[model samples]
Target: MKRNPMDFMPAYFTVAFVWFTTHFGGGFASGRQLVEFFVQYGWYALFTPVIAIAINALVFYYAWDFSVAHQKFQYRSWTDAFYKPYERVFSNLYDVVFNLVLVVATAVAFATGGATLADVLGTPYLLNTLVIAIIMFILTIYGANIVRAAASWIAVIVITGLLFIYGSNLVVTLPNLMTVLNEAPAPRGFWYALWQSIKYAGLQAALLGGYVAVTDVLKNKQDVKRAAICGFILNAGIMVLASAVVLSYYPTIISEAVPVVFIIRNGFGGVALELLVSLLIFLGVISTGVNLIYGGSKRIVSVWAKPEEGEKSIKNKRIIASGIYVFITWSIALMGLIPLVAIGYSYVAYLALPIVVIPVLYKGITKRGGEKGKSNELDAMTAADGPKA
Candidate 1:
């Protein structure tokens, strides 16, 4: 039965936070993404983020609803159904995109951890990366459920810290922000700025696999609508807010390897807040990397290894998979946070825009959003009627 968006608010927000937390990791925590993707555009930063985010809302709504309607919860199956006729090509392409997302995401998380700590401790960046990798390797070995629960709580804490840090700093930096808006030239121009914004959305599109994977939580089309609306508001809203905060500092803090740490250390807050933000970012790094690493490990084990039907076999492959992926990401992180976000991430966005974002947006607009419009849809217990799919 169709219900109001207001109904099932808890479940809707639960789904919404998944997208928000997924987006709000190392790239976001450091604020480099905002600077590289938006703030660099000068005044254009004001609206471009919203544009990219609007696309994310639409794409996620269609992808998730289509997944629920068709009962293609796993990404591979969904790709087969959604990309039919062209599935032979697009399906394999999307596998490349999703796996690349995991690599970039895990690497960024590691780099964020390394850079954040190295900024404070005067430690070696690669060593810091290894330390973070080792910690995650040990934790993920325990199981997924523990880290999943920890990630939820860390999301709440990170949100609170963001508000406390940025909210206060914005008021103090209002004059600086206004001056930059009036004086700084938007060197990239309007069209180029818009392309960057689109690419930013494309980089985020890589997460559709993770986002759509959870749509089984939506009982009906109403829940899907609510989740999409809430997802856009929270995810886009936070990015815009971060843009505003980072914009206030403008060209000076923009070049910093870690903008959040720069802001806190310079004057935004005292030593205590700096350490606090660092701790939160570290927690986010650990949780995000652990979860993503496990996903990669699981995929490797399930697909190629196809371990014998036993926990022992599966666990052993998982350990090996985790180690290999971590080593790959650790090498990537050595490039430093700025190069990884600006250079490495931009390449992924360019790749994802064509295969992942554009196709998903096309399907979302052209296809029937859900099975609700079908006359021969299934009854309860099937996906159409939505009894837990």
Candidate 2:
């Protein structure tokens, strides 16, 4: 009755897809984040995705290695590793910053969903936000199990739909693409663009660390490395493709509330296809919101409850925490999507660089190039039931 090891392949891809979706979310899906961070840079944007991919790979590997080495799977453990005697102080700071950013990110997702609903179905913005928030709560109330069940499949479908939609846009724009490329403006310039890309990657790096912590139970270095590689390739490939599509229609679509949706609605030129793509993106936003709230609430529970705590008690704590997060995010979502992505995410990106990304890079650079005691420790931890709380 033992599960086949080969079965882990699908699970591994599922985790990979979840990792991709966690970062993609509403902002990326709508083309707002890409326009701000990448498309605005003109031809220089091409280089940014490569850099983001490298940083993503390093951050992911660091997260996985840290998780397996200490048998701890949350941000608190990273604090312990990096801050030493001041673990509590640093960890609490990380916890606060992370949760605050997560709240804002969830709100951004809600806002994106609301915008999509309004554009596609003419729904009121407030009503759309409320409906999305309620649905997110329903999914998150069940914790990571529900998120895990929904996220990967949602990611696959949405990403595939995006490819088709964006690819079609690219084809339509191909004849004028050269003219468009020549006229593109680099308002931020190359150096600023490079820095923005790095900062943006750092923002996602912090979340990726915590996500890898909560969702993946790392069995070995190979598992960690495999997931890291898969995550990086998927993240980079999708972002690059999405950015290319945005670049093809830049400046014109930049001011729109939901750029990608707008591009699809107008450019794709079919009512049914446009609606299907819009619905898929709206679902993607919801899925990302669910994953964010679930991950953040689970981390809060892990920090508050001891690893020895009973499952029922832990589950109750997660539901309560997720409920509070959902309420706050729903309120903040009314502030709108542009401000959320423009101001909130940009600030968090800078904060995350030094705190989360650098520490991970430092660890990777300094750790002895050998597994040594890592395997034995992981074995012992798994024997002890594996990071319970």
Candidate 3:
């Protein structure tokens, strides 16, 4: 099939954006994650949105650029593209950690989603896992395009509703907003706030990198770059708005598992609020599930596809691999390991920082030495590794 370059960028960007937003799952939707990381810091949470946006932007920018560059050279995956440039003991360590992290993340998603579904619907968690696992398997077996189409429209609706709810509260509660802010407890020190911001940003960036991997399908570098920029802006704006809404209802939000729902119920009341919250949470869970299945399945399949070696007939292999992955994920979920894994993986994500930072750092150092550095170092590395496929 002849590829259409024009559709590539938008499609890729859309997929990437869906992946990014959905990465944090129920955490992002409920604001509990933010509360855990930022709100506890009180007024220090104000700087979090800014630091997170900047870090995410930088991470996405580098990942997107590297993906496009390496894809043009026929690289099949980020690991294929980056592993060589960063070849070392630590690079191998990163590969092991990265792959393990991906597996653990998908497992956690399945577990948590199952738990949430069971809790909300009053079904057994195992039943929920069975159902979600089947659905995820079907969606992932098809590929990224199907995943993108299924999620894109639903994501738009959820994001729009969230924005409306948050925006309305910002306006209606504006008169008392300052009072709420003043009453909020402050952080212990500037250093604490700084560390909190870095932690939040680093965690978010690691999650965002998985999203950027899907951008390899994008034909237009400009579209990928533009989409990332716009996506970061949208994310930052929403985070800020959410933080404000959260702080407005501060101290009270401390006890809420789902703070966004709390804000909606308190701000709007009645059927409108209920319906919006329901839709928001549903879409949030569904989009996130789809992305996890897609990314996890793709990674599993790619390991065996061996594009460089001209392997074929891997479709059956991919399906089987994906099924096993879903099975393991569902099993762990049924065992109620999701929350523990999610919390553990948050730190494991820090393990990815060195992997991501090294390439960008190398790029910077090479840039300083002009063409000589590139010719001696990067080109040599590329020549030694050869083209990916």
Candidate 4:
């Protein structure tokens, strides 16, 4: 039976949800990054979500268009599309920056996962990091299909569990919600607040490009758009819910590095809550790790492995590349190099800002204009694919 593209649209939504949730892991969920950008500014911190959503919408819009036009469903990383236009200076810059960032991000995730495991299960951080890396490596080596299956199941459980936890906190802290909002100090000024919001949102969207690459495989532009919008809504809702949960215990959250864990401990003291939170955290890290490894491996394999030419098998090459990455990331993490790597990669992302912003603008405007005005190559490709020219 031939599968209709429309039938896969719902899958895109799931893909988007998993993508956003995974990207939102390290800093956004921790509240550390949010605090650095918004909370310090006070009441104005509320605007951060708005800014983040707008940027996310724009990025996803282009990502969907690029995927549909190309008709190539295996774009496991945005750099593939990004390299299409600015192949000379910008593409090279993007490639370098993305790999560098992935290395650091993977390391950070490993470290964080270890720390979370230690906190929740009394396991050593070093051992936990190795365990996660090994599991993630094996999963990536198998391929995206396997990763997607795991992510789909885990996302359902994590989202449902988080909703329950946040909902309970909201009800219990109803009175304090408004007080926290009103009494919080306003940012130093409107401009400072706005810039902080922009930077925070921009960085997140930029990094999320790697995750959005998977959507390229979806055959329908409409599906891509719908999925992106749905994903954006879900992400915003979760962020708001998370913020509310943390704010309920503002004092405790303000000092704690892992606010989500703290919220669980304070709001639900039983072993059940601890176990649930631990599982959610573990799944969150695993989903993100798998996505990162898959993205990195795909990029390397596509460039170096010439399976069509019979030089190497793409699948086997991908497995080898993924293993190498996992080993390197784990080794760096074991050496306690996560912090320095994270900071360096952040700087590299700043450098790659131009590469991301330009193509995103081009894709959005051209795609929004309709197929007639699209580039000649894209129009011909779409026509060949029978998308109604």
Per-prediction TM-score to the true structure, in the order listed: 0.85, 0.88, 0.79, 0.83
Candidate 4 structure lDDT = 0.62
Error of 2 at 269 (Å): 4.0
For candidate 1, lDDT tens digit of each residue in 173-283?
A: 778789988896598799999999999899888777766544555676788899899888877777777788788887887778788887777657888888888887887
Winning model by lDDT: 1
- Per-residue lDDT of model 2, residues 22-64, tens digit only: 7778788788988878887786665697787779788777766
In angstroms, the error of model 2 at 381 is: 13
Question: Per-residue lDDT for 143-228 in model 3, tens only?
Answer: 54555665667656766877888888888666556786777676566677666666666555545434643554455557667766
Count clashing residue pairs per candidate. 0, 0, 0, 1
Q: What is the lDDT of residue 195 in candidate 4?
A: 69
State, as a TM-score between 0 and 1, how close model 1 is to the true structure: 0.85
Looking at model 4, residue 76 earns an lDDT score of 31
**lDDT: the better of candidates 1 and 4:** 1
Q: How far is 7's C-alpha from truth in model 1 (Å)? A: 16
Q: Residue-wise lDDT of candidate 4 within 1-389, one digit each (tens)?
A: 11223344355765676566566554554455455556656656555666766676777677566656654333333344445544566556666666776776677667667776788889998899888888888877665446556666776787798788777777877677688776675547777777666665555555543564355445577777777787777777776676665665655466565666776676654577766766776677677777777777776766675535442366677778888988887776654433433364457446545656556766677654233223222212211111221
- Quote model 3's TM-score: 0.79
Model 3 stretches with alpha carbons more than 4 Å out: 1-9, 12-16, 72-77, 83-85, 88-91, 100-108, 111-126, 172-176, 306-312, 334-342, 358-389
List the candidates ranked by lDDT, beginning with the highest: 1, 2, 4, 3
Name the lDDT value of residue 236 in candidate 2: 85
